[model samples]
Structure formats: structure tokens, C-alpha cells
Target: MNTRDWNETLRSLNVGLPDDVERLKAAGYYEEAIARIDAYLAEDWTKTQNSPYSQGLCPHMDVQPENPTPHGVDVLRDAMIAQREIMRRIPAEYTWSKADAIAEMQRRVKDFTPEEFEMLDRENRMDWRFVEGEKRYQNRFASTLIATHADLARRQIDPPAQPDSEKERCRRLHEKMAEQGSASARITLKASVGMSDEAFAAALAKAKAEGRDAVHVRAWLPLPAACLSQSDIELEEFTEEPTVIAPENAPQRTVCWEADLTENRSFGVQYSYRNTAVYTDPFDTPSAPEQPDFDTEEQPSHIVFTPYIKALAAQLTAGITDPMEKAKRIYDYVTLNVRYHYQPSYFIHESLPEHCARDRRGDCGIMSVTFITLCRAAGIPARWQSGLYVTPDEVGCHDWAMFYVAPKGWLYADCSFGASMARRGDETLRQHYFGNLDPDRMVANSVFAAPFTPPMLGFRADPCDNQTGEVEADGVGLYGDETVSSKELVQYIEE
Candidate 1:
């Protein structure tokens, strides 16, 4: 299948499971569910033929009538995908038994009891699901419980402290930029000084790909692009010569390579870039009479304006007219209300912002998308910006947002960081993130849910954002279990 066909198939997986298959799976009859799905796939149902599974498979599934009609095919495919997702979610995600969870909690909370655990479970403070007729909790349930529940946080003993150096770095950067008046003024005054030069090496582990018997393997690794805050990008080296390197300003930039399995099983790229910090106090700038309509409209798949989102936006921005103020309110709502939780792959989520808003739990990218969606719904222009959070001590995937407000131009919002600040009771730093960003970033994507330059023929590991990397073998996508990604910060220099 071509890229378009594969993309359609990926979207069709979101149609949901057929009723019978769903019921079977929910009752812990996994093997029976698989058998029913296989039986469905084996049937030949034409458009003229009436079958219990034919209706509501897909909106356009009735247009074509082959031996096995489009509706039958779509249903079969959706059922198979659902089965695979169910299996994938069990062993890795829901691993902790009740005793295991309580034992782990006791390590952190003094005299933790089964009764307390039951109460927390009743309040839905922990993430748990049924697996093989037994209740199992997620691996991070204890941490999430403490993070979200105030009483648990207070009862916890000796939580790890945030490094003072990190706090000082943020404070120094903010003070230096605020002294320069505005983001633009800060950029101009620093020009070449107070910039961070970072080098990162990303690789797909060879050991993970060693046993697969495939003729060809293809890979794409993120490369830093030229943006307002990032520049002087250099694609210094690669394990093998790249087949294509995306243009500097590509929304989702990547360095791509293809090789025979016999020749190479792993791929890697080493690159470096310079990032300058920019700070804008939205309160200090006066808004222009007219604002551009850019990024102020809904973008489907994730950044959509559903009724709940619209109502929430209306309530947040009620009795307020200034775009900047509306944007700040949206930011505050996300940072203060949403608790950070590690998520599964983005491919599994149908609507990120909606899920986050309703569940009140999400990771960095989810919170960023939620902020962007709410901002657009409130008539503020907001967009996505993500890649890596590179610091002197650590390097990892990260995401944040950017909003436009007339005369102030574009500003930044890192809701995840702001939420951390709120938890720490640092109001000043929490407010600082509303319009400013640190220089410890590497930006490779400027748009959300954008296709790669040379699109992958199979489904992407993460269709929404490219952060870690993507790899495919023989037109089949390899997920995190089949692939290993590593990021090492080679150099960090302050200029």
C-alpha cells in the first residue's frame, strides 16, 4: 500500500471494535475474541449481503462492493487492530498486582495500609485495569497517586528534591531576558552571548533489530531546524550517508536513510545546534488593534473544537476580551488542573486534547496540545513546538507551545513545566512560563500531526509528533518494543 492508503488504514483503526469482539475481550475471553475476529475476516460479505457486522464499520465502507466488501474488510481490520492493542496494553502497562502496588506504596508512605489503598482506588487515584480476569495497576500508579493526591503527597516521606542548580538556571535566564525588555529586545541584545550550544547523538540499538529477517530497513531521525530561537544547525555525522535531509524550515524535519538488512541493522545521527532564550512579559506589551487569523482555527484529529472544549473555553474566557488575557487564562487552567502522567503512544489516542481535558491527566505533549486547542477556541493563535529538552545534565524528548498576540508577536508556554512549578508553590516561575522559554531546547517540529518529508510507507510509531525516531522493516512499522532509541548529550557550552 502507498502512504495515503496506509494512512487511511491507520485512521480506520479508530472506528472501534465490533460489539461481539469487544464483549468477548472485556470478559477475558481473549482467545475466543481472536477466533471470532478471524471468522469475521474469513467470511465473504458483498454489499447486497446482510451481515450483523456490516453496518457502522466505516463511513465510506459501503461505496465499493467486492467479494469481501469494503465494510467487511474495514470491520475485520478494526477488530484485528483492537485485539493487538489489547494485548499490547496488558503486560507492559498493567503489571502491578494489588499486593505489589501496596508493597511499593509502603516503601514511600509511612505505615501505608490496605484500607488506604482501597480508599485511593475508590477515589480513582490510581490507574488500573482488568487483565485475564484479575485487576492489575500500571507501573507508575504509585508515583501518579502521590503526584495527584494532596494527602498522599503530604504523607510521602523524603521525596527527591529538585536540584537547586536547575532552579537557579531558570531564574538567571528569566532575569537576564526580563532586563532586556522583550523577547525581541533580548534576542538583539544577547545577539551572540548567553546562547547554549548543544550536541546530541540519537541511535536505534542494533541488538533490538538483530533477529528480524528482513531484506531492507529504513529509518528517520529528527534533525534540528532553523527557528526564531534555534540556529546554526549542523548535521555533523551519521552512521551511514543519508538518502535525504529535509529542508531547514520543514515543519517536521528528519534525516532519512535506507539500507539492506544484511548491510546494517542500526542507524544513528549526531548533530549540534545553538539555542537562545527569549522572554516576553505579555502584561508589559500592549495588544495591536487587529490580530492575524493564523493558527486560530481548529485542526482535526487532535486539535479539534468539540462541544466540551468549546464550552470550557467559553467559561474560561468569560467576561474577558483581551486576547492575551484569554490566552493566559487558558494556560492557567491547563497547568493548574491537569496532573502529569506518562502516556502510551500517541497513535493510540483519538483526540489528545479532549482526552486530557476530560481525564484531567496527561504528559507534556498532551498538555501542550490542550493549551493550543483551548487558545484557538478562545480566538488566540497558537501552534506546536517540540523536539528535545537538552540540559547540561540530561537529554530527553519534550514538547511545548507558542502563541501569537498581535503586537507582542509570538510567545511561549510550557504547561508541563508550569504545572511542576505550581506543585512546587513557585508562582513567579509558573507565571514566567506563560510567555517565555529557556534556551535548553532543540526544535525539530513546528507543526502537530504533520507527515514526514518522505513519508513512511507503513504506519508511524507516532503519527502526531516525531521525537525519538521511527524505523520500518520491509514495509512494516516497528514499535517501541521492537526498537530501542537512545539520546546522549555530547556537549553543552554556554556562550
Candidate 2:
């Protein structure tokens, strides 16, 4: 079959490699087929070998520009050889198992042409309404599951207890949820003014599935007196409002760290030949190699990031108490507890909880991801936001979390950096991180693993789950040293 036919077959089967490669091999173009495969493999080598942090003129190492790093080139070469071997072995035979296809197709997409990948992204992003709705859908999806899981985990730790009063019982449930790490969890009361039956169903289904560990009602939003009277569902009477915020009506903000030049001055103006390595963007995936389409029903991961910003949501209620106190509780836990590491250099389908279990440390993305996971686990709605940190002289990449805390709206939290500052004994960085943020940054985009509303014509160059930028035909910009300006942030900015 011709290339077109082969491509059609592969497309129909949802595989990444072209059918021509297989046919060519069977057609006895042994040398020619190997050569073709080698060419395809070459692309993989080029894309996969580069770290998001590689610096200097020739970011990919294929062509050296005026400024080149010896260390960077060495890494590029090593990755090139490694990926070349991986590409060489992709069987030309098209055995289309969904499980196998999902795995292998992801590989092919990663290796596919950047333009083609962009096109796929564009196709997915054509509908704006879908994209916005996905944000809301994502919010509900996270709240339901996280609440369920937290409740499950809580019940696993503490069974329901009989108390002297209904209020006591409610207090016991709240305490139980917190002990099991569901401190941020919330419950929907049927007496709420604007709550819908659909939301109630979703919450109920989730709680039942999780065995009802962390459940509560907004003080102003009273429990359906009828439902409470009928069922053994413990009732709690509160004279004062709960201090926590709910996810639905929270304010969201982005905090940028302004890079100053004083600290970035060259020490003795030194230059040395150092070897470096180029790694792909951690979120890069072959299947969705193009930019993401936020509007598409085809979410990148079935395992979505859930945000539990219930503390923020508490303020939205009419008769709520102590909003700031609740917010402080959340800010403290995330900023103090979660550790940040630079490992897990790539993104996968596993949720942040899974990542936390495996790698104790992660960079900003994973930290923000975990924040979302925890917030959702607590019944608070949260979402992702990432972009470049623009200072006077340099642009560095950053990621942080935003949660819906009703009265205050969607508030921004940068816990990863907050944790870092605390470790370094920088009280300013730690203090400014929790509720307030530094002013020297800009948000290029927000939302994690979310596709650009209007997809590009082809798939993205690296389309797993991340924010990306391109400086050259083949170079993929990543976090750390690979940043466009790198540490130069200190050189350009005055303040």
C-alpha cells in the first residue's frame, strides 16, 4: 500500500506509526525499510533527548549556534543514542490491542511531526464552550472523587461514633475526617439555598462509594430536616458558622516572583566547559503530541487533579464563622507539609496522590498537582495554572494552585515555593507565598494538562500534560536551566 493508505490504516487503528513502515519491511525493502525506520527513529532521538532545561544556542545539540554548552551537548548526544534504539524496535506489524495501542500509540505521537501534532490539538480545541464547561466539569469531577476518597480513607481510620448530642456527633465526624487527612473535606446540606438535586446525587454517590467518612453541612445551609429526621444520618446543630470555605464561589489569582539582577551578577565573570543533559518536558506525551484542546471531551487523563479548597468555600455561606482561620489551616498544611523535588521529570496518567506515594519530592508542577489532589480530597474545588515568571531581565517557568473558597472567590496559593523558602530560612518568601504572592511574575497561561481553547492544526510537539514553548524547529523548552533566560532573571530586573 502507498503511504496514504498505510497512514489511513494506522489512523483507523489509532496507532502512531505509519502503515508504510510495516508494508515496506514486508516488501523486502529490508535495507530501505531499516533506513526509513532509522529516519523515524532519528526524530524520536532528537525530541526525547533534550531536557526542558538545556541552555545556550544549540538547545537540541543538532546544530550549534554561537553559544554552546559542552555539558548540554554531551547530554543531547547520549539521549539521541538511547531514543534511536527505542525507535528501531517498534514492530511494523499492526497488532491493535486497545491496551497495547494506548501505550504504543502514545510513543508514536511523541515521535510524530510537531506540525501534525499541532493539527490534532487544533481539532480538539475548536469548541470554546466545551473547553469552559470542561473547567466546571473538571471541578465537579475532582470534588466528587476527592471527597469520596478522603471520606473512604477517613472511615478506614475511624468508624462512625455515637455522641451525646447531634452536635457532638457532627464534631466527631469532622475530627475523624481531619485525622485521616480530610481536614479540608466538606459536606452538602440539603437545606442549602442554591444546591441542585444533581449535585446532591453526585455527592451521595461519591460518599456511599467511599463509605461516608468526611461529610458535613454548611451552618447556614441547614440539613434537610426531613431527611435528617427520617434516616440515621447523625444530625448536628451549630450555634455559629463553620469557618471553612466552599469550592464553588472562590476567587482565583496568580502570584509571580519578580527576578532581580543584583543576586545574578557574574562571580568573577568565569566561563568553563561543562557537560549537560537535555530532557523532554515532563508532561510531554506522544499521543497528544500537539497542544491540548481544553474544549474536547477527550481529557488527557481519566485520573484528573482534584482541588479541595473548602476552607475558601466556607466564606460563601451566609452565617459562616472565621474564614481566615480556615484558609490559614489549608495554607499551613500545603506549605509546611508537602516537599518539593525535581524528580519525576515526565508526566504520566497517575494522580498527584500516586506521585506523592512514589516520589517524596517534586517540583512546582507536581506540588501544585498534589495541592489540587488534597483540596479535592477535602471537598474543595481547585484547578491548575502555569506560565512564565516574567521579570525585568528574564522569564522563568512556574506553577501553582488555585482553589474555590466561596466568599473570597478563587485564591492563589504557591505552597511548593513556600515550603522551599521555609527550608532556606527566608521568612519573606514563606510568608508571601501562603495568601499573598510576590509581584515580579506574569501568567502566560493557567490550567494544567488543559489544551489551548483553539487547537493548532496538528498535534503539539510534546503533548502529554504540560506548558511548553519552542525556541527552534526541534528544541523543547523545559523547567530549570533549559528556561529561555535561565538565571539571567537577576541580571535584567532592577527591583
Candidate 3:
């Protein structure tokens, strides 16, 4: 059928009973239960009409009105009466909207094809009595179908239907990072304490251009610890430095959690969009990946990513027609919004959007999720890439996204590292990370919650999604190493 015809058919088919049926009972029209029951059965028929059943012995024999069976009439009668009873059990305010109903419908059935729409239409308009089951059954089937479809849709990310060349492209990039310095070359992170923004920016720019893999940062003046005691320090932006802060007379007591020592570690700070809590994890990577059951129908779509995510993706794509530009948009948005919130590697994979949303902070894992959500919402296919962060100095579990943008195909975007580069005055990280990924990075888990292809020696499964981390060679925690921050390195050297 043409689009117009299809639209009409869909509308007519969806003319089921109102989502809130209690209103019918309130109006003293208890008999309306029959119509509501019929509407639901009609919807089921339309949704499942194209079944590959026998041409002779149809399962829904009553659906064919000319050959009406006494059994079909009894089924519809029983279902209606049961629905009336169900209404009494629930509160009066309960209701599902039309949109909610459609969403519900999609989730209920797998392998539900377009042809079923025609069947449901015919069944509802003609053999309305053929619908079977009681009131409880009616709700169960409908609820199950709707919930399942939503869950499936949430987990499924439709990558652009391109060729397999994307995989090869990623491999080449990995090789580049693999060969960056001597295979055993040690990475050094040097930083300047108490520097101004302009000066820090200039220093970072020099480091970046000279291939001097180091980050430029200023002291968290006063200190990073005062927040625990709720110290009232006036923070001001310094044109020359990172920030000019006036410290209160309160003693500069050290809060174990507040020390900026995390700066010397691999990943930098983390942040979230929904909450105001910030933390730092000293491990190189966040956590190991965890696998979730694939059967559930309710998935993390509307709840995890806020509406602002969609707007951010659109904003990033403005005027930038190139695939690289689109990638840049994705990269920039994440670094700009999500800051570093760190926890122990053991806890990284367990709580994701929950921790990030409630606390408003996360390490790379959270950043990756936020970035992936925005890209998917904008119709850009993105997936997780988790593996050891193999820097020149150390290796630890790290996380990032592989986005498929037009022309560029698939590329990695590491927002945390890219954001650090931006902070240090290197615009290239912000610009290249979107469509262009770092060749220095290697991917471990190409698919989240699934076993890695070709596997690994003694490869262990992730207990949850986004659980990726690393330990020292001796089997201890030490995420990966970030030898890029200048301010952090200065402190490290002094110690």
C-alpha cells in the first residue's frame, strides 16, 4: 500500500478501546467492557495476521466470520466479563496513552511482520467475537509484547549498512598507536603547578606540537580536598592561569578522597549531566565489562539519556557536513559536558547511568555511554570498544566508542583524553577525535556484554555492560597510565 493508504490502515487498526477503560465503568456503562475487549482482540489479530499457519485448519477459526463457531462467541464473552472484573481491582486513575499503547504493542511480539496488520484489521472489523481469553489474559499478552519490543529496540544499534572495510580501518588505526614510541618506551606526564590559563594553554600547545605527550594543568588552588568539609572558597577564572581562588581561614586538612593525586593516573576527571557529585578513581581503567540477559523487553533508552542528548548531537552536526566534522561534534559534546568521576575499578561496571545520573560524574565508561547515547539518538551508529589502555608506559582497561559516520565509516572517540587535550590548549584532540580516532589505542571488547571474537588467553566474561578495566602484571589494580598531564607530572616528580 502507498504511504497514505498505510497511514489510514494503521489509524483504523489502532482504533482500539481507550487506554483508560475505567472511565467507561465510571459512566455507568459497564457493558462498554465488551467493546474494549473486542478492540484489544482486534489489535492482536492485526498484529499477528500474517502468521504462516495451515491454509485449511486455521488456529483462529472464528476469525473467519462466515464459518462462525459457538466456541469463538463463548471466548469473547468470557474475556469481556473478566475485563470488567479487573477494572474494579485497579485504582481509577490508571491509564495508558495512545503512544504508550503503540510502544507497548511493538514490545509484545517478536517476528511481528507488517502483514499481521491486515489480519488484525479484518478480525476486529469482521469477526470481533473470535477473540479469546479472560481479562487477565488480555493484559498479560499486550503487556508482554509491548515490553519485549521496547527492550529489543533499546539494545539494538543499527549501524550503517556499509561493507566490512570499517573493521580494517580500525585495525590500521590500532597499529599506528601500537607503534607510537618504542614498544617499551616509558610515557612521562609533566605538569606545572599554579599556572594561569593562557600560560598553561601555551605550554600544552607546545607539548602537543613537539609530540611531547604531556598535559598542562594548574594547581587545584587551595586544594582538591576542601569540598568534603564544605569549605567556602571563592573560585574565580584567571585569564593567565586555570583559576584564581581565595581560600578561607579553615585549616587545609587533607581529605583522602579530595587529593588531586588522581591527576597523575591514566584517566582524568569525570562528570555527569543529571547530578552534582564528583569523584576520582586511581585505577587506570574503570571496571570490567558485564553481560546482561538478552531476554528482557524493557531497556535503557528514555531513562538513561536525557532529551538534552539529542539536542547536543544535532548541535554538534551544525554546518559540519563532513563525517569527520560529525565525529568532532560527538567528541566535543562529551568532553564539554561529562567530567571525570572516578571509583575503584571493581565498582566501575556495576552501576552506570544510575551512578552517573545520580552523582553527575563518571570516568571514561560514563563518558563513553553519554557519547554513544547522543550519537544513536542522532541516528549515528555507535558502539563500545573496551580493552587495555596500552600507552607507551602502562596497560589497563579503558573504554571508548566506535562511531560510524559517513565517509569516515567507523572511528574511535575518547572524550576524556580528548577533553584533557583541549584543556592543555591542543585543539587537535577535540577536532580529530570525533571522526578520527586515536591510532595509539587498542580495542578489547568490540561488542558489549558479548564474548570477544577470537577470544583471548584465559579471557573472562564481563559481569555487566561497560565493565572494562585492567590490573598490573602481578594481578593488582592500576588502571592504565596517562602520561599527558603536565601539572600532575610536576607533583609526581616532586614526590
Best by TM-score: 1
Give the winner by lDDT: 1
Which candidate model has the greater TM-score, 1 or 3?
1
Models, CA RMSD each? 7.4, 27.6, 26.7
lDDT of 3 by residue, 1-495 (tens): 111111111112112234545456445344565467566544534333444342344475445433334223443434343343333322221233334433444554455444543453343211111112212112233432332234433433342244444334334443443355211112222212232344334445665686755543222211221321122222222213222222222122110111122123332221111101112111223222332222212123211344455465677787754544455566666676554544323211323543443444456767776666666655556766653343333334467766664333345677766665554465643544553444233232444433211111111212222223211111111212311222221111100
Off by over 4 Å in 1: 1-17, 21-43, 47-91, 107-110, 146-165, 181-214, 263-265
- Please write out the lDDT profile of model 2 over residues 301-397, one tens digit for every residue: 3223223223333332325233333334555655665555443223211344444524444557767666665555444556665543433333456
Error (Å) of candidate 1 at residue 134 is: 3.0
Q: Estimate the TM-score of every prediction.
A: 0.81, 0.34, 0.32
Give every collision pair in model 1: none
Root-mean-square deviation of Cα positions for candidate 3 versus the true structure, in angstroms: 26.7
In model 3, the worst 10-residue window by lDDT is 271-280
Error of 2 at 444 (Å): 1.5
Where does candidate 2 have its weakest 10-residue lDDT segment? 266-275
